[model samples]
Target: MASLLSLRARPAPRRHRWTAALGVTALALAGNGLLAAPAAYADATASQAVDFPTHCVPPPIAGIPPIDGTTSAEITVDKAAPKVGDTVTVTYTVTKPAAGNPVDLALPADIMTPTGKVALGGAQTGSVTVTGPKKNPPVPGKGTFPPFSMTGTFTVTAPGSITLSPGDYNIHTSYIMELDTPCTVTNPPAPVSQTIIASPQPGANERAIQLGTASGKPGERATVTGTKFTPLADVTVVGRAGAAETADKMTVKASSTGTFTAQLTVNDKATTGIVAYEGTAWNADKGAGPAAYTVIDDTPAPPNGQKLNAAVAAGTLSMTQAGDTVQLTSVDFGKGGAATGDLHGVTVKDFRGGPAGWSLTGKVTDFTGPGGAKIGAGKLSWTPSCTTKAGSPSTCAAGSAGVVGSAGATLASTPNGALTGGEFTAGAKVSLDVPAFTAPGAYAGVLTLTLT
Candidate 1:
């Protein structure tokens, strides 16, 4: 062997072989993945205007009734190009003021600036409540209300199109003592809907696994090793030979280290060609793998670098309830009175990426008490609410405040296309008016929830 100085003196290409190989490999990769396409709605500013009706009771002067008025809101998203993990600032400005309770007398300056919920749907679900600047101004019998603007910031956690809308709010005022006059958006002839698009971070690399085997003859069996898959998950390996397909479509469980080996049998009728094989593991616990194939007779090698695909199961529309039973807090009716309690939360899971919306309704049977005393279901009322799970495709809205005693009442619902596939929760505050003549006993009623 020559000395180090002598070895260096030998003539060499300015570019090393390893460096050149990497460059060629990178070029090949660029043609395969183009994930940075700009979003369609990447404008500098996105804003929406909505006109809706609200009903609120004016601070009680002993005989005042709830007032109805129209309110306009302008929803604005500050960032034009938002990405996952970015803090996005959103502002809700009252274009037209909502009417407060019309007091018979001048209301004192005891009302706190209002706080409202911002409803979100589409690629993202859930709402964020933000408080406006505190300013209490004395109002004559009838005055403009909710003129303050509120700004809330949320961290963008997922990439997709998310929609934002306005929801219920609470405004408080003092007549004798501080009391809250709640307001709800009864209807929106034209609801203000704004959408923002979030993009994936640059240079995001997903874990990849390779599957393969050397050239083989018709009806031959091959075993391929797979790595970098989910640890201890069940995996299915499928082999295909060009257009003439059907090879070893078999399942194998990964070791604790996430590595798996699958054996495939080449189809007896496989034509001679380069076959492609793909492996997938959709639910780990379920180990449910759907088979897709194209098989071959066999061809030359080194061997083609095959693709290992792991796809999510196209599941059905379903729900998994954690608490199937509920024991409401006991209420003491010292004197004949009404009892109020909250209903337990139920979950909604939709994986059917369809274009249709879904609704959840509750119909309660009449409550029966001791000695056969009966209470009508119409006496029970619920204020509905549906909370969206993070990363849900659409936002769910609360149902109207009504009793289930009718044909049936909506507990919570989502607009058409709201639940392409995601999860949310439905719950409500329930009030029961117990008759004074009923005897004291544990009353029971069946709350039937229907999903369509």
Candidate 2:
């Protein structure tokens, strides 16, 4: 116990040393804690370690101008697809304007992106100029202003949309505009857009017409038929041959099932050609269809390879006598009605040797045979009135007085009806007028005819 007490001298002030050691330990622990935690800076310094975002925005798109008149635009697609490989088209039309001064417009050049998505590809810049009206524009009829335009296409990539994907592309067209100037940022036209489908609707529902020929012989008839004819109206059969051109009075109507039939006759003595006989069918709204058939006067052969008579066959009868012109021969009348058949042979001869002045007219009836034929017939009378010919001769010798005359002829064989037998001879004739200036001479006229 005595020895332990003596050691105290060395322990004097040991507390101070211990306190210094404790202080050092505390500083080390604090330094270590600071190393484990990140440094916080209130102010940032410029350095390459930091990152900042940069962005770009396209300019506002232009709009279309206000059109003064009625106009329309339609959008269609060459191909539309969400499944890749689609094309789109938009059509802009301005109508009701005059033939020359039509409403001018613009079209979008940039359709879609290669990634299969729609975009306003305005990557590049260019302008379009059209020739039209200008500002301070003149009155409607005063005079036309110069033409002006400002429309163009741009390149773009896909835009973000729920329906669109990153790889899909579609043509995005803006409404075409009617601009006062190519660069005038003023009123732009409305935009039209369309998407091209991958597959187009089938053409199964389309209508069509097929024609065999356009022209034929006078006694010949043609048949016409077409799909989607029900909507057709005012179908007419026309024949255009040399100087003799005629149109049938009957108009064909289409059936309810979109089909139509028209029977046409080649009665006019027109030169046969590809354009000889024409069939025209109109819709209830007068919409016209393509010509049904072309006409061709193929030499007709009788049944069983028989040769048809080369002589002229008669179809109808007409009489006229004003001045200087007389019936050289009688007229032969064919069957009158809408029926398929050939006409008998008929002829007319001018009795007045030369030009003369006279007035004559007559009615039309059945035909009669020549001298030896045993066929009975009676003369046909007129309506008891005479008038100048419609659209008088455009070209006639000057200083010549016109002659007019009429003749009434009857068959001596058959009393009441048309000639039943082929014999067309021995008919009665009565003159309504004879030209006073006619050369004094014996005038004889004759008529003949057939029907198929």
Provide the overall lDDT of each model, using Cα atoms, as 2-decimal numbers: 0.51, 0.22
Tens-digit lDDT string for candidate 1 (1-452): 00000000011232100000011000000011101111233323367678788876655644667767777887777774686534455567766666654555677674555656667666555564444554656776556654656555444445676667877766756456666766778873236457788887443322233335444555666655655556776566554332223444667777787676666666644322221122452222222221222334244444666544232333444543333222233333444445555655667776644334567775654543322344666877789988998887778888999786735688777775422557888777776666655544334333445565
What are the TM-scores, per candidate, against the unseen true structure? 0.39, 0.21
- Cα lDDT of model 2 by residue, 67-137, tens digit: 23221222222223311111112112121111111223323333111101111212111111101111222
Model 2 score (lDDT): 0.22
Q: What TM-score would you give candidate 1 relative to the actual structure?
A: 0.39
Residue 197 CA displacement from its true place in model 2, Å? 7.0
Write down the worst ten-residue block by lDDT for model 1.
1-10
Stretches of candidate 2 off by over 4 Å are 1-209, 227-234, 240-245, 271-452
- Give, for candidate 2, the lowest lDDT window spanning 10 residues: 1-10
